[model samples]
Target chain A: MIELTVNGATHRVDVDPATPLLYVLRNELALNGAKFGCGMGQCGACTVLVDDRPVFSCLYPVSSTAGRRVRTVEGFGTPEKPGPLQQAFIDRQAVQCGYCIAGMIVRAQALLERVAHPTEQQIREHMNPNLCRCGTHMRILDAIRAVAATGELHRAGEKGPAS
Target chain B: MRWRRTGYVAGAVLLAGVIVFAAIAWQPAIPPVKSPDIAITPELVSKGRTVVALGDCAVCHSPEGHPAFSGGLGLRTPFGVIYTTNITPDVETGIGAWSLDAFMRAMRHGVSRDGHLLYPAFPYIHYTKVTDDDLRAAYAYLMTQPAVHAPAPRNDLPLPLRFRPALAVWNLLYLRPGAAPALDASPRERGRYLVEGLGHCSSCHTALGIIGGESGRYLGGGDVDGWHAPALDVLAHAPRPWTVEQLSAYLTTGLASEHGASAGPMRPVTDNLGDVPPEDVHAIATYLMTIQTSQPPTAPKAGAVADASQLARGHALFDGVCATCHGDGGPMETQLGRPPLAASSALQGPTPRNAIMMVLQGIPWPSHPKPTAYMPAFADNLTDDQIADLVVYLRSTTSQPPWPDVRDEVRRARKDLSHD
Candidate 1:
């Protein structure tokens, strides 16, 4: 049994420790926000935060995160009370088909946590791993900027319900 | 005995050395790509941009966030979903390292730089018709794009379809010979090349009938990813059949009079083809109008009639199995606003393979705002010969001009349908 805290909920999952965090989150924990695009660490659809650093969950083993805090798209907030990033996504219409939005948002969330005011180039470089098919990058960048303007990034250190 | 053993050891060593040497020599070299000697002028760039717009290479080949032409798009087909490969000039991942001749072979012949036959799913059959000049320009434009190093996922075709060698036979039968067959013969011919070659009309328009060669006719519909190829027939009775002007309008805007908006597979085609030069689009319309409507070129003349006894047997089988939808008023035209046999382009279109395929594999109900016709697959109920005769009977009665000897072709289509 491996005990891990995802989105604020502590859970025990029975699986091989060597299994990538993505499979454990998806198959055992029933969290599908982390997608399995290219299992070989090419596409970054399976991005998540481990102790506030972006990691490709598809390549990150569960054992490596034994005590590390894992945050996912679900960790953000519910639809009724979405996080600033989620609201920014909505305002900017950054979610076309919603397949890649979770990963993109997660990456952005991690970036904002590190750098409060990121330039467009920094955002592009940092968010390179999270791929979107519907040409939503410009809108996504706009959404990120909009969230930054709201001063959410500066106060990212404030804990919100352990998520 | 000791001498013999020594000889054997020496022989083994020699064999290993030869094998290693051969592998070193045969390391499938990627020939260097040479840009045309002509200077890159504003006019050249503008022309290349137009081609890019028409080709829409950026749409499928380049994912939204990826560098332009750094491909990773997932294209779903019936056989298996294939990912688009990177077209960038990256030496490690993209075609940046490909020779001009290699690129030409890949585009015109579907052979890759590694000397492997690419799957027809790549639509090289249509790209094969691209002129040397246009291909060079397109290559030049791609070369100028950013070099992105990202290898795409390989296609996962199921079972025998994965067998690459068999494609050679399929190519021999279906693929037209030679590159962009001299369009100088006529203006209409040039238009046909542009549409059929660059436009890739056959990829969607040609119905892959239950049989082989029997299904090569252009713009004869087939189901791909649940999207039916709407007949582009010029006949007055075709479903929302458009005049040349109307066709151009629809191709440009993805909408037309009486017809609903183009959706599904057609969306991409129109999205790309709409950007083509107005004159080119008009030329396509001209060529499309000239599609042989009376009959296919290979159809047998009336003089070589089928045996009367055989035809009689075919008639009886048709009545027993096919009379329900296709009988009495002789296959209702305008079934659910879709034209029936009386007004069908099928009667006037080339080849009976599509009709035969429909009978064997019954079309999936067309998806529209309003539900259209549904036909059930009949493989379980009918034999190959029975289906063939039924097809012949339909053509003899409804379609003008006799059909070609399609028995073997139908047999092949049936085999493929069975596996599919």
Candidate 2:
């Protein structure tokens, strides 16, 4: 048994200690937004936030996340009312097949959280760790850039006062 | 005449009461309709022509050697044969007399001017995602095509299936509510409109459900026209993940580094997509590469070198037989610019079929702009076992694992090999 906090919700789950966090999130918790791709951590499809930093869930053991806070794409917002970042994605149509988006979004979310105004090069460098086969990297770049230039700053400004 | 209207309704009621199964109409969540602003200028026609090409309408609508868009192509499906309708300006047989309103309705609602429910094979489900301006332009362009007097052949359907009303029921059961695409207005958005709307990329790339609607992760791939339409999503299963540059290059030119080349139905698609603006193709790629899925990795490959004995056999064969064109600075590399074996996309994908297909049926004549460096078929020249060993040798040298059934793949490719 392990304790896991995901998207602000906590649950206790029983599984093998070595079971991948992605498997638990999907199979046990039914949090399916994070997808499975290359299980070797070569593809970022199973990306989620561990303590607000993006990590490939497939290679990350569930045991390692016992005391950490994890966030999945579902934590972002509902489809009807997506987060600013997700809305930016949909508005830019930055998704296809949308299997990688949860990771893409979470990874980008981490980047934005760290660097509120990343340059295009910074954006590319940050996103290179993830692989998208559909060739939508440019749109993904734009969606992130758009969010950085506009909404990211506003949210960052709001957070600076408290943090 | 007075009783005809009442008779139709009463007969429908009686039919419903008797069968209780087949007579119900399907109700789809239809998007709110928008009246298109009409224009028939030459520029609009030119734009509309691009839209038509974007849709690849001619390929399916007109069979080979037939007048373009004449609409006699038979699309075989589980249900039955559904023939494409003529869109040329013929009053009796084609849509010549359809007003802009009628055309808009057809594009948006999948209904004919006479109110016949169209079979989904027409891909109106995707077309409805199109914007009114583009729809108008496509309509204007279609109207300009030379009128074809050809009437579509009668659909060979059975008694209950012959009635178009069943489509209403199917729509009710399967069709999700349609909503106007919320527009944010970016080039990527434009790409989305073309891809999701007119290009209908998902139609072929997305796997189909039991009832024929899109299933699984959209663009996760399925069979289309007898060829495996590889998934466009992140579970792409390409031996090497497609880089955006490689993807754009392939989508625009039909060949990408490492993945080799597009063949089968993809050839024509590349031809049509190539004709679109380069930026538009990039936009489509931009949209494609972002879709993600995850799966557990395949077991780590045993080793770079396979069984030492088989490796030696494959090496000897390659040196003796394949050495002429495939050796370092060999004819294929120097003259044809074919990548070295280590870099071949065929070797990189999850399966060996593409590589075997290449060996058995060398790239015939590449489309123009792509240099034509042809290779002859090796099926007649080499034994299946030898060919399989050669591929295994190539695989052993690369970081990629040897495909599971090399001999079986070679046999299959040889059986289907043709000069075309």
Candidate 3:
């Protein structure tokens, strides 16, 4: 059994040590925020924050994240009470097929945490590993920029701002 | 009066030394000739193409996004950056006016048409062994190419090296200008001629001294642009020993089932070799097999467990970043037939330099042939600490002992990346 602290909750999962974190997250825990797009790390649909760093949870082993903090899109907020970044995404309409949005949000959250105001170039470079086939990159960029301009993401983590 | 007489004697000795040096260093300029009116046959031109490919002339002479043989590539050396000269037959800047004899002299003696001493970076030491027939064919092919008027940038050498005559002394010590000895007409002999002469494999494969002269350890391991060119004589030491067929396949296609794909500097060489005839590559493989120095087989010892905290971080990084491509169940191994990381020579080697470089630089898309194996560079994505962790994790999986200084290796690789 591997103990994982995910989204402010602790769960002891009884599975093989080699099982991917994505499998455990969706199967045992039923937190389906992280989608499984490409089993390989090429596509970032399985992105999650391990110790505040974005990693491909699909390829990441659950055994390795034993003591680290794992945050998924669901950790940000629920559908009715979305986080600042999520609200910005909703306000900017940064959704197409929506398969890639969860990963995009999780990856962008990591960047926003590190850099309060990322330039367009920095955001583009940071988001390069994630592939969005729906052509909603401009909207996604706008959403991140909107949140950056408001500076609400910085305050959201310390004190949850009402949506 | 006694001190003045001693000064006069010292001055006289210095003057005599200067005169002797000048006598040995001076070379007369060859007269320029018009583009030869000789009718070159298509057969000769075709053969010349093969010869030029074998020589890998364009690899040094041409910079990327430039016309072939229109030289401007800067070769970084221990001395300094030496720019390659334009070999295209442009009358103004290149060898358009060079007569066959002038070209021959440059190839065999490291002297330019204007009597200037060419640097040994041009590999004339090895070219001196090339036969006259091959030289003529190469000259014919180069002259037929559309000339580009590009002059080379000045070399970035120190003050003493800036003096061209100094190379004359260096040549006297290192250069041996003559054709290689005649051998029986066999595939092995043909391979030897190609490898030793025009192929110039030793230029990179052989170790170098402080002055950049070959250290006489022919086909022994050497470094090229921070990547280790593994010793050619120790094929038997590989996890899956290389056979003639495997080497031939690797030479032409840049991929072997048992061994990893070629990356870094060897990629371009294999890309060039892909265009050559199969027989030439096969012969090279055939010849290389004969030169193998057998070693006592080492028992695969189990690696000792590493620090738990560091191992955990490394395992996490590997799972998140490296395992997608390198894992046993990874698509690269299952579908593309890439060997496991344990089989990689870079991991099994003495140092962590190549492994660090492989992660930092990865393999860029090939230009000549279609891309077979491509890995995105982690230099920008992963920090030095992360890379060190990944490398340590990889070494732990191997049968060999852990590398002593992985973090230092990563730092060195970062330095090389900055230079690039």
Best by DockQ: 3
Better of 1 and 3 by TM-score: 3
Ranking the candidates on lDDT from highest down gives 3, 2, 1
How do all models score by TM-score? Answer: 0.48, 0.56, 0.73
RMSD of 1: 17.5
Q: After superposition, how far is residue B173 of candidate 3 from its true place, in Å?
A: 1.7
Q: Can you write out model 3's per-residue Cα lDDT over B270-303, one digit (the tens) per residue?
A: 8778888999888888888888877733443433
lDDT string for model 2 (B1-420, tens) is 879999999999998765754334432323322322355789999999888888888767766545778898877665667788888877778887777767776776677867677887888778877777777888888888888998998876667877777677666654543424527666667667677888888888888888677775677666554345767775344556777678888877776755656665676677677788888888778777666456633543343345787777667766644565678876656643345667776666556666666665455444344543344444433457767777888877667766787788677665544212
Q: Model 1: what TM-score?
A: 0.48
- Residue-level lDDT tens digits of model 2 in A1-163: 8888999889989976546788899999999999988664457898888776677777555756766789999998997899878999999999987878888998888778766687776777668668888989889888899888864534454332110
Kindly report which residue stretches of model 2 are placed more than 4 angstroms away from their true locations once superposed. Answer: A1-163, B1-39, B72-85, B151-164, B177-182, B235-240, B294-327, B335-338, B356-394, B406-420
* Decreasing TM-score order of the candidates: 3, 2, 1
TM-score of chain B of each: 0.59, 0.74, 0.92
DockQ value of candidate 3: 0.13
Model 3 chain A TM-score equals 0.92
Which lDDT tens digits does candidate 3 get at residues A1-163?
Answer: 8999999999998987657789999999998988998776667898888877787777666766767789999999988999988898899899989998889999888877766676777787678778889999999999988887766555344431110
lDDT of 1 by residue, B164-263 (tens): 6566666776677456654476758867877677777767667765423327456765555444565555334443345677667667665544443455
